[model samples]
Target chain A: MEILLQQIVNGLVQGSVYALVALGYTMVYGILGLINFAHGEVVMIGAMIALTVLQILLAAAFAPVLAVLFSLLAAMAVCMALGYGIERIAYRPLRNAPRLAPLITAIGVSIVLQNLAMMIWGREYHSFPLPFSSTSHQLGGAIVNDVQVAIVVIALLIMSALMWLVHRTRLGRAMRAVAENPAAAALMGVDINRVISATFMLGSALAAIAGFMVSANYGIVHYYMGFMLGLKAFTAAVLGGIGNLRGAMLGGVLLGLIESLGAGYIGDLTGGFLGSNYQDVFAFFVLIAVLILRPSGLLGEKLAERA
Target chain B: MSINKSALLVAFGIALAGCGKSETASNPASAPAGELVIKIGAAAPLTGPQAHIGKDNENGTRMAIDDANARGVTIGGKKAHFELLSEDDQTDPKTATIVAQKLVDAKVNGVIGHLNSGTTIPASAIYFKNGIPQISPSATAVRYTAQGYKTAFRVMSNDAQQGKALGEFAARVLGAKQIAVIDDRTAYGQGLADEFVKSAEANGAKIIVREYTTDKAVDFTAVLTSIKGKQPDLLFFGGMDPQGVPMIKQLRALGVKTQFMMGDGGYTPKLIELAGAAAEGAYASLPGVPLDNMPSGRDFAKRYEERFHQPIQLYAPYCYDAVNVMIAAMQKAGSAEPEKYLPEIGKTEMDGVTAKIAFDEKGDIKGGAVTVYQVGQGKWHAVQTMGGAPAAKP
Candidate 1:
């Protein structure tokens, strides 16, 4: 029972980061109809920014909490601007062409950003300072961390605020209208460009926060930190139903839980019996089972997008 | 009949003249310029997971070649510069095999390395077949030295010796009768962990639990907590510093206060930075500090800092020593021919950055020391040197 509780806490903490990143993926997919492959790179960029700022604050002997806040703000501003710039130069060029053109452009942009990060911050690992996240919390016989709790609450709050904005605000209406039908929305006097840029900015801001969160959680950052996280976030988005807002969130949390549990309880036995090197096989196998059981995700609609 | 005989004689004379022109062999004086440049083949991971260490190791070899040339080492009374022909195997065994074939085709006089044990194991066969002497600075798996290849020699202490030292430290000194073992599941990682467990068990310490994490793994709370439940006196890890640092930090964060111990892998300065002062209590075992402790090490540290703009790690000096040894062997043999210089390597006892490196018949460096270390107040402090452990006799 104790083992199960500890594993659950571990999964929840990991799941929260995935959920945050997946939210950005789902948001962009819903509004722009693009997978936003570079979204993960934006997360990496955010991490780099935060790491740089954190180091500066640390040099001055600032408290860990204050330094973290400053890091998050710097990371968010830079990553959001990066997202806007990418959309303006790369995505905007092929917006009117075939979807394939933009998809290819997104991939190219992703590689460009990754290489750019590598060039700036060599291939060495950078350690981020986070005082708040380092402290753990044990409650009701369950072990957890303040950072894990913060990630969960922050995701919930950001998601709530986003839901309200999309359902209530003028810009949100424009985004929804554009996603539904660009031609009709343009006829209704909505600037498709404005909506798309706004969508990217929003996603980028969330991704930047997530980037800081993950680095703080993991305690190490590097140029390629976002690559694996991005792949997994994209997987989570698909698992949640490509364009469904809450589906991505659900998928992200579920995937994290599965990985932690598999790694904790049975990975040793399984890895020993078969091959320890391929330990991730069990959790990913669970993911396949989930996909088979529910093709479009647990709460996602298989036919809604086409409808 | 006379006309036919005259035509046959003329044709036969013409054919003989053509053969005479083609067969006019050049005399010793007329022979083209005779030159042989000594080349050493280097196979290692220059592009993948261990790229940093691999590239640095190759650079060490390159530096030795430069030093040798600057001193004008004579081979058969002609000045020859050592050349390193390198290929990136990306740490893959299959790619290492291909790179080995390429180096064999290039006909290098000697070989430097294939850094990781996994790649090194497969690549050693190519050098054995081609009669090239390979001096590895970093490969430390127990089986690596057991292959009975006459040419294969590593300057550093093997992983088994490291594990034994660490295990003994935990059992006899720390008095940890029950311990938990963990590994990263790679060849070097698992192999070393197995050794530590075997030795620890033999020394009257019971392995209460064993868990594992991989490279790039960020969290080990579940595993740590499980071990905590077992209430072991120490946590022994068989992996590089990547996960090792975080495992220590998380073990503290989760309030599991068991002593943490590892092999030469956790001795890097980066692990100190990652784990911070919490690393102070951590224990590790590795090859002893080089022969010239004060001036030579200080000189190396200063030179390395000036060149690379960062502090050199534990094995960098050993890497420096290896290339020096190879070049010394080349100089003494009086010929760059691999067949001639390989036997010369067996009797070499030159002063080097690490130690006075001299290889025995089985290619194990004689009189090397393995030292134990503890992270004391955010610094890795050497405790004692462990001697007389038999180097592998193949």
Candidate 2:
């Protein structure tokens, strides 16, 4: 049905955003073996900063393209700095300590960043400026917008670039070496601290782009925007195999498609007893089902314990 | 021992007297000028997504207080000076209760507040328990006035009136046969949407699809796509401007050309700015006469704009009226105390900036007005203004 195709388009657009944010989660977890809870906050920061920059530029009568370009770059730069700071101050000290310490610290960092953003932005929903035209192109009764197209294309490009960075580069090998055995990697003259910091920077930059794209796609931004999104992205990472790069991407896109289609059809399917508002329930159900059926994730390989 | 006990009792009495004296003395309004200082606590979402509207409400209260002070209002032969104690509820119900208690503890004579129904409903209980009269500038949920709390009062029309008007308009004015309704699922949004659906159905418009979303949600593709499949002639959303803006944008982006309808929450200049070209032809219903039609509205808008450096959002004029109506009650009763003036509040008749302010027994504005607006040429033009139960659309 055309409606089904339309839902898929919508799902893919949403899925790409989730996949982008999920990559941030999986990468940090892959390299650090610790969930960087603050990564979502970085996403929030990115969106807020981008919106603020765009507003400033627009107020100054700058071209929309120039404003958007500057905004994205500013968001990336600021988020990268924030990511580095979070790692250096919050996680680095606790790297060898109990895992729970860093995890709790990451949560603390998230809360702190959220409150900080609220204080700065004044806790209001800001309408993000649409740099591109919002005109819709119809394809067989389905609608597509420039923002959606941009999100999907950019997400794929980022994922491909990330795949290459993680698999084909010398730094990529060093990152894998560090992940496999930090003690041995350091003994072999790899800068474990530098590698970990680089991973955080890379993950934060990806999240920043995701944050910017999500804001552009939604056409709105606010302080608490990242909380639910971060949770969903984390679910995607887990569903795709947390440390498995490709799995995260696959999981995120799949989750997005399922949620969109499920929400689209659930009301009619249920004789109006349930509505699309229950869409979140379906997303959570996927998480629960995935956890039950494949705890190692769809593409995750079971790693043997050290002797 | 007896002498020491007597001394202690004397000290305690002196301390009690000192407290009462200092309370009056320290209040800048009292200032030992035989002035009766009435502290009116105003609570709203002064720090959240709703802060812009909250600030508008607070500014209205401030303007009224300024006017009252300029007029040198006197009650029972005492010069009455009004002091506004503003608190931010942060748009949270729990925070609203805490803010309500804080205002009560501050011993405010009256309260004007709590922009949202969710905040106002819970906070009303606190004011009622403390015998403090509370007037909401914008809380329009029917249950707010229906709660049997004499302390609760609102200057604007409730959802029942606004929704009915919107529904009738959609059916009669737009001549829509099939309609789809969506709500943000907040107390205000759901309540307004329910009333609209009820009245729309009553007016012979068949609802094809009903969808619900949270106030924070921005993406509406799936929901709109489903609604699009049904091919409704009209789409009604019961939510604030923030959600309405994006929803409309997304709807248009998806090529759904159904005539969009919204309640007062979407009836703002900000909505136009946010939705841009997508806001064209959208219908929104705001409670009360348009500002241009009000006798004092033009002057009030000018003064408000001059003071705030921003155009008035929705509810500011009503807020201005709410404060004056409360002051009118105090003047009628010849007293500034809550217990004395609370009864007089129901009997008030004041020509305020918004309307002839008076409350029915249910604490709702008597014969509250609803104005229907259509966005034309990138501006809101009032198409109709109806009072009482709207007359079958036409």
Q: Model 2, stretches more than 4 Å misplaced?
A: A55-67, A94-108, A122-124, A301-307, B1-35, B389-394
Interface C-alpha root-mean-square deviation of candidate 1: 3.1
Model 2 native-contact share: 0.64
lDDT of 1 by residue, A1-307 (tens): 7767877777777777887788788777776677788889999999999899988998899987788888889899998899999999888877778778888888888888876886687655667777553566776566667777887788778878888898899998998898788789999999988888888888899899999888776677767678778877777777777677788888888877767666665645664443322335544565577678876766666554422
- For each candidate, give its TM-score against the true structure: 0.85, 0.90
TM-score of 1: 0.85
How well docked is model 1, in DockQ terms? Answer: 0.16
For model 1 the local lDDT of residue B224 reads 72
Per-residue lDDT over B319-361 for candidate 1, one digit per residue giving the tens place of the 0 to 100 score: 7777777777777887888888888888888766765567766
TM-score, chain A, per candidate?
Answer: 0.90, 0.97
